[model samples]
Target chain A: MSQLTPVATTWVNGQVADNLPVTDRGLAYGDGLFETLRASHGSLPLLSLHLERLQRGCSALRIPFQGERIEAELNMAASVVGDGVVKLVLTRGSGQRGYAMPVDAVPTRILAISPLPVYPADRRDGIRLYSCATRLSDQPLLAGIKHLNRLDQVLARSEWQDPAFAEGLVCDQQGQVIECTMSNLFARVDGQWVTPDLGRCGVQGVMREYLLARLVERGEPAAVSRLGLGALHEADQVLCCNSLIGVWPVVRLGDRVWQVGDETRLLQSLAEQVYQ
Target chain B: MSQLTPVATTWVNGQVADNLPVTDRGLAYGDGLFETLRASHGSLPLLSLHLERLQRGCSALRIPFQGERIEAELNMAASVVGDGVVKLVLTRGSGQRGYAMPVDAVPTRILAISPLPVYPADRRDGIRLYSCATRLSDQPLLAGIKHLNRLDQVLARSEWQDPAFAEGLVCDQQGQVIECTMSNLFARVDGQWVTPDLGRCGVQGVMREYLLARLVERGEPAAVSRLGLGALHEADQVLCCNSLIGVWPVVRLGDRVWQVGDETRLLQSLAEQVYQ
Candidate 1:
């Protein structure tokens, strides 16, 4: 009933049907990949970046992704929706109850564009983060891919109901800060821009990928590392970034606090440029 | 399109709708619990066991579950689709795009019935198992519940396309044998029936719960432990079970083979009776 109030346009497998077959593997087994791309003035600003990530995710999940079709669809969707977030869901489609993949799997392509969520103005000043008790389980095989199986993130996000707690930081089993409930994390420690390594768990968001490369291109010492709480405490700055939000300066994380630093501001501006 | 054959009746949230809203959280984030029950002469024998597991799973996931509505629905489904399989899917329903639960989540109830799949005559003898390379990720929070997030089993089952191999046995990251892709596993190691502990990962199947209880009642020691490949190889007999396939002796797992032992045979008979 809640989802009945469709906020944006939706297309399923090139058709405008929002009702999917119940047997779709994406529902039965969460066998799929998804990408959330930012649209600006009828064009996907980071189309290539999102498509690249989606392709890699498809390869890892063995979901046959038709890149050309998706690119065309995204462009069409961007032109239609204009300014919002475009969501593309690629699933292995319907299958029998058994876990075995159907001999001839027809992948399902779902494209939806929704109005960008309005963030509170305080978020720009940097939002408060809750250290979620719901830990991200180490799954090296499924790590870094934005697969539909996101119960960990769902559970982590469910931890706090307060609006003040804009996000939650989740750790892997080994106590390494992997990511926020919805974004990838980075902290400047000892003059190095270190993002959490997603080799074990967490999604390497498209924005995070872009910013990491941008930092390196600027001749900044940027690298992926297994970050811990201590790293945040010792860092000069901490921030979280995602395609939808661009970059948010995490000024407060429970008891630990950090002022928005120059590196974070530069990255934010660079990310906004890229997102634009 | 293959699923359009409507061999079974389907009802979505009290309405006879075969198609589900694509926005269903079950499809979105795998936020759901499901039960597949075997019906004999229009009656579900192990309804309590299945319902109990579903309840527990819903509770763990923080999804609202209405037992009374489901019980009435099951009875209605049982009468309509006599002597077949009754499937129940409980999803957090559709919601806004985010991990946060809907302020008012009207959980979706999906009921479908399908004709019981035919098994080969040789199935009574035993089946060979494949040791899949895809390992089940360790997530104690999601362990034991047959949630919609089943990509691990899907990947594992995809490892072997050979129909000769009935199922694939999966392991946790620690290399401990967990369960078959579609069923629970048990091995008579050192004269005790030991099922792999689902403390880390794996679905605690309905048939497994019944078999374990029955085995204990008969004074045949049955327990759960962190089972390893070595333990299975050293076992006198190994077997797999599910609600649909009562109990089948696992005569082969890779190169390690074993005869259908007395314990397995006895359990098979008892399980068959329960299934009937």
Candidate 2:
């Protein structure tokens, strides 16, 4: 048996450890929130933004947040790998087998560092998208936050094995376009940028939120609009983005193909300034 | 510092361990299947049924099934606690940070034993139901299996703190009644026993399946029907059932109220024969 290097720094009650107690609610009910970030030269450019999102998620879920300890763990993870990906998981800790959160339970924090994923060379050129049939549920309470409950994405990703299809576009139960399986989607409609409103469904991706801010700063009119399937056919440009992968333009959606547009390229360059 | 007994018996590749390696996919994305069984005198009634469901879920998700080892571990868990609730968790095991399932992953198994949760004294009399605003997603692939992704139920359950309201009834995005937060729902409509079809949404509860089979064997036709909020309101009687709770009649649903019915009592007696 090969010994695996300690990839995670786990904290139970303020002290960092190598493992979590078996009853962690994170492992049980997936009672947790995770943040995946790209680190460059032992520092994360959007570290504060990532933490802000994590805090917001915690607040929404009623999970207690320990920002100082989480920051310490992040530093420890970054120190191990100067330039890599750092994944932070905060769980409600161990509890009895019931659904009720333990009254005085201390939350568990886990931070893991790994080598950065190798992005496709053609990612810069643009990516091809598949319109998946799997639809996201509309749960306003759980919307707009990154949580551990991601079965919808897993099922959608499992639908195809063709490496050529970079990602799949997922719609809501109402047949409204929501997002890609892993990334938030944006489209250029009539020379203006528009993205789906995640208030009802889909995750409000960190990078997408950042890009929207950049678009506003550049004096570009970007709207949080509810997209229909017909809108994709009429769009000038389509793109997908997440925190890890800054931004990727969509060159094709099923049979319809479009050349990479200037707006997509501009957003990519702006996100790259912070991501790389 | 005080030491607490571990609530779970964890196994990694056949050896007993408390903490799963930080790379467990269950922790990363909730990539897992779970079976909760009632154990009496070190023997589980309907063990085969639970195993069949687990195997079916694993096959559906393309996770490798190791039935022999699972049975052995379950036997070990049964030996630890002669009578209680036994929960079996099978995760896709450890993998690098990504959604792609590893080609060769030894699935991680967790066996936890907990005392049976105490039910409210009047549960046999009836339970008050709350109409939840959280809508269930229409995903056929995940509808019937008890997978680990359950954020929707968690959020719905968190919506209320009133002990009078036993459980919440959820609906689909189209406003069709689906199931309760953690249990399958049934109603008496037009002198027929009808339960919401799980082909589009909701987890197929093991007890619900068992009761349906018993009803059929007794020459009673229990239809798997699609229900709407209006249908539920018009029902003569309503009940909920799961592995943990044999059967609970609904006494009140907002302004509408139901009384304990003959069919509910008969199903409860049948479940008791198997559980007790």
Candidate 3:
């Protein structure tokens, strides 16, 4: 449903520069961080959360943090459309062909406004999953932070084109379930809502973190735990959550099918209150 | 040493273009392949080898191949610099913000030439190595080919900045020594040269492959074998090779030191024949 719309913006520090330079490290080495935010009725729900995560990611990557400029840019992006998705990309500016960071490099920022993708009405009606062959690397240093090195996700996502499969579950080299390609996986087991710990592999999704806090506030126990294939197979209820896609229940994983449980629906409703 | 001499000419779709759209998948997800070649007297010594490797990388990533245009672009790039280094970057062009490849994508091709980096004369005299804690993932699908998703190498390289430590050796999850950040490792053990197998991790450097073939032709037994830390420490001689560096002897890895031996010097002489 994405039609060509007149999306306009401005870039700083260059002439005729509404675009990033070809020599940007983001393009060269994928040296960048991005935040995809949804704005409804000219206001972003949990905007602070998105900005905090972005700032944290920038700090972790040693990218210069420009909070004031980013807030102004976000406002400008939202002004064009009353409601939509705004993507803010911050790159380590231009550099010569090498991995060493320039001593006096200025960071580049890009802001793009686009219509939020429309999801299927039954997207929450228990989706299907494929166990992706692509395994996430167990890199504690790069894990948890949302960096631009996403080849693993791209490869895993390319494995299937069938609309029937909503997402894919990826594990680490040790066969420990990490998370989905683009979302954080959560499962209800032994009367607790649990998600995989991203200390070893996977991104610490903003929505996943928010859900964990919400569950705690409501006196519902939730935890971040190490998970394995056996845990996934024995999970009473399964769901995937991302900032864009609030919560999606999984009805089947491979040949095993699951029913949409009460906890899954409860989490979906809670996220809808914030996302919708 | 990189002065603004405008060292190279780049052509896109048979026209001179320098800037790519920010939406390019290479910038978005690093969905691209690159080749760094050594050019001398307006000709690339292993041009066919580099092109074949690039084609193989494209085939592995499912990226479209445009060899004719790439050849023409390389010729133009070489014409600008009689002796230099030529870098050819092929990206999956612009796409919507997603991992899925655009159904009809015309890949972006970038060709640039620059002066060869000056290596220290004493670099031939064994260099120090650091065993980095950054472990490479055992992903065979993306292994061997030099793609843009190199955060692992970037992280490993950033671990040290000591001039004495010329290179860092990375290992896979199974504690198998893979390769250096930008080069391939070879060790002379039992009077035979052996390099780590790249079937699971590490990039297959063109120069390393060339040397392997040359060693085989000379009746000097060579092998692609799985290497361990113990084997590396007990090796008779250690060397690292790449297209740019040619061959560099390893004098020390942590506390263990290796003396420059005849086998390493012979390999260096063989590589220098082509490099110089």
On lDDT, the leading prediction is 1
Model 3 clash pairs are none
lDDT of 1 by residue, A1-276 (tens): 122123448888877767899888898889998888888888987788888888888988888879998898888887777788889889998877777778789999988888889998778669889989998877888899989998998899988998888899999987888999999888998888999889878998989988878877888858798787887789889998998898899998878778998889998899888645
Model 1, span B57-133: residue lDDT tens: 99989998799989878877877778888899899989988899887888998888888988887877999998889
DockQ top scorer? 1
Candidate 2 lDDT tens digits, B56-84? 88987778888987877676666566777
Candidate 2 at residue B209, lDDT? 86
Best by TM-score: 1
Q: Which candidate, 1 or 3, has the higher DockQ?
A: 1
- Candidate 1 vs 2: which has more TM-score: 1
Candidates sorted by DockQ, best first: 1, 3, 2
DockQ of 2: 0.50
Candidate 1 regions with alpha-carbon error over 4 angstroms: A1-8, B1-8
- Which structure is stronger by lDDT: 1 or 2? 1
lDDT of 3: 0.81
